[model samples]
Target: MESLRAPPTAAGGLFPPLPCALEALPLLGVDFSSAPSRQKPVVLAWGRRAGAVVKLEAIERFNALPTLAERLSAPGPWLGGFDLPFGLPRSLLQAWGWPLDWAEAMSRYARTSRPELQAAFAAFCAARPVGQKFAHRVCDGPAGASPSMKWVNPPVAWMMHAGVPLLRTAGVTLVGHAAGDPARLALEAYPGLLARAVLGRRSYKSDEKAKQTPERLIARKDLVDALEQGRQPWGLRLRLSHAQREDLVEDARGDTLDAVLCLLQAAWGAGQPRGGWPGDADALEGWILGAGTVPAP
Candidate 1:
């Protein structure tokens, strides 16, 4: 037997090597869908980072969650920044009297049907005062992400219901939560958080073809240009072929660009200690990968 125990940590006692050092490994930025389809599939941007330059190598589209799940299950020393919530709001979980442990909470959540979840969340909101309907995870304030429990608009609650279970099944180690394959690390990402920093309320994408105006197109171009030059916050420049740049900008839906933004965020996290997640990330309410300072609850 080749010693059934796991491999030893890095020289600094890090369980897994920091991402910045693993420049040769693939970094994935996933723009996930709670309900993937032929029209709006799950989009993944794959690349490798060399110092501050992240080279875009490929763009993958999966028409179904199973396909995405299959990709995640494959062997990896790969790190992913998935645009999905890894956990629910701690306040919501406690109020509903749900399990607080990550595993148990997710297990119970997996079993709950979508309608039941919607009804539960609706009831929770109905009881709260106006302007304070939904409970928020600590990171939501800083990340500018929607409440994970929101059932409409972005339907992130459904995204959590549809996506998080697949990640759990894939056995990737969700940062600050369940530990799995040390080589495969997953972090919650909000591309809009990064985009807003660069674009400043400018709209870069729209799902409705009719709403995809020329201004949005220009915003996309400007955003891409900023990334290539290495904008603030992360300071990592994006290296894309002219064709890749055109492809990202031309895809009016913005899925490709969102995925790439996530990849950059993941790369930034990889360079940090413990994937940039804080030590006190909630037990059942995970934090976004690069969202700075948790606000006071």
Candidate 2:
């Protein structure tokens, strides 16, 4: 493994380099929306990591799924941290007699309709005990992420349905879940996992304008400061240009910032063995990129 420090460029600028074999690959963080539109488009943060510093290079928005698909398919040697579930719980799959194979499961999931998925999940919950309705992946507890089968609230289940197939179609390797193009690796990421470490349950963003308060703005600033100084467990600092910093802090929805957070997680995983996936990670359930040392469920 190489040191985390970035090398200097001829122009006196720093060129970020990822560790080891992935040194040349660009890093991407995607804040995905199942139902993307002009108002709430899918956000992508592009960057690179060298040593401890991860530089923010650009932020992009895709108003349509096709644009996202084109971007994923056109890429090579890029690792992405996507804010979406890559797989469902093993328990849920077995209970429903759904295919246990990752690829087959994803195929079936993609073929199913949204209403069918919702009804099925609803029934699954109805049959279970009130407090223990949803079957959870092992990483969910440690990452504090919603269930992959959950349909409402965060609608992460829908996100998985919408986004995972694109990765599959793009032939990107879903690390620890399915094999595809090794040069294009995709890891599940949860920005909340990192955000909570700094904010401690602070509400840092809200899509609704009425709920975007001053306190949340301060929380975003604090989170940004923490990342810039390499305060997280990943030991990777975030380097944003002045305008980039303002854009992230000013965006009340936090989509751009969340993508960058995911980017850092991906960069950290790129340096680890098996992209930081634990040996015990469930192939059918997948795992979050940086939810380290989580106990088995």
Candidate 3:
């Protein structure tokens, strides 16, 4: 392993060589979402090595099923920390009389498409009183997400439906599922888990020009400070250049922040003692919240 204290070199104004230490980390954190289309939707995913706070990487965004299948089949010992929900809301499952296990719920949901899911959920809501129609899972309440089953406001259920099966087909091991390969781990992680711990509602990145004032720069500086001092819950450190800092601060849409979140997940994976890569079920699940059920394959 390389020294973590070394500073990185700024290159060509826009690129920086990440500290060599990041190479040793193996964790892969993914932020996934689907864009609507007249045909099939597009899936976008990105993340970084677990223990290293630099060197972000993106999984190729796919508009076609064959392209996605190719990426999923590529070789690597990856512990993917996807942003999708692993479990459906207990309330929604109960109301629909669906299975409660994460895998089963996703499997059941996978049988339906986007329009089908929306229509089914809408029908369920139509029979209930206006405000009480949508159902939420335990995490949804705390995460402040719309109903876990909702097609909008994050549409996490569709995320799982569309995403999980790919992992399954690719033969990756899901952390909590018995059917998953023990070597290729997949876990659920929320970027907010680390962001809130460090910034505490302080806006660190944005897209709006008006909000990109000096005050936000100071917040970015504060976030940089926290990351440098290892104040984040994951005990990770970030290395950034002055130009990089300015760019991250000026961008308002939070793309830079999302990238940093991916950086932390990479850092966390790199920190693992099982030679950086998660080597077994215990190590993989160690990073996951055991409260949620692991659905059967």
lDDT of 2: 0.83
116-156: candidate 1 lDDT, tens digit per residue: 99899999999999999999998898888899999888888
Ranking by lDDT: 1, 2, 3
* Model 2 residue 249 lDDT score: 97
TM-score comparison, 1 vs 2, better candidate: 1
Which order, best to worst by TM-score? 1, 2, 3
Q: Which ten residues in a row have the lowest lDDT in candidate 2?
A: 8-17
Q: Give the Cα lDDT of each candidate.
A: 0.84, 0.83, 0.53
RMSD of each: 5.0, 7.5, 10.9
CA shift of 74, model 3, Å: 1.8
C-alpha lDDT of residue 30 in model 3? 56
TM-score of each: 0.92, 0.91, 0.64
What is the per-residue lDDT of model 3 for residues 157-275, given as tens digits with 9 covering 90 to 100? 67777777777787775544424444345655555556656667676654466776777677777776776667765566666566656654554555455545654654564344322
Q: Pick the candidate with the highest TM-score.
A: 1
Candidate 1 segments exceeding 4 Å error? 1-20, 293-297
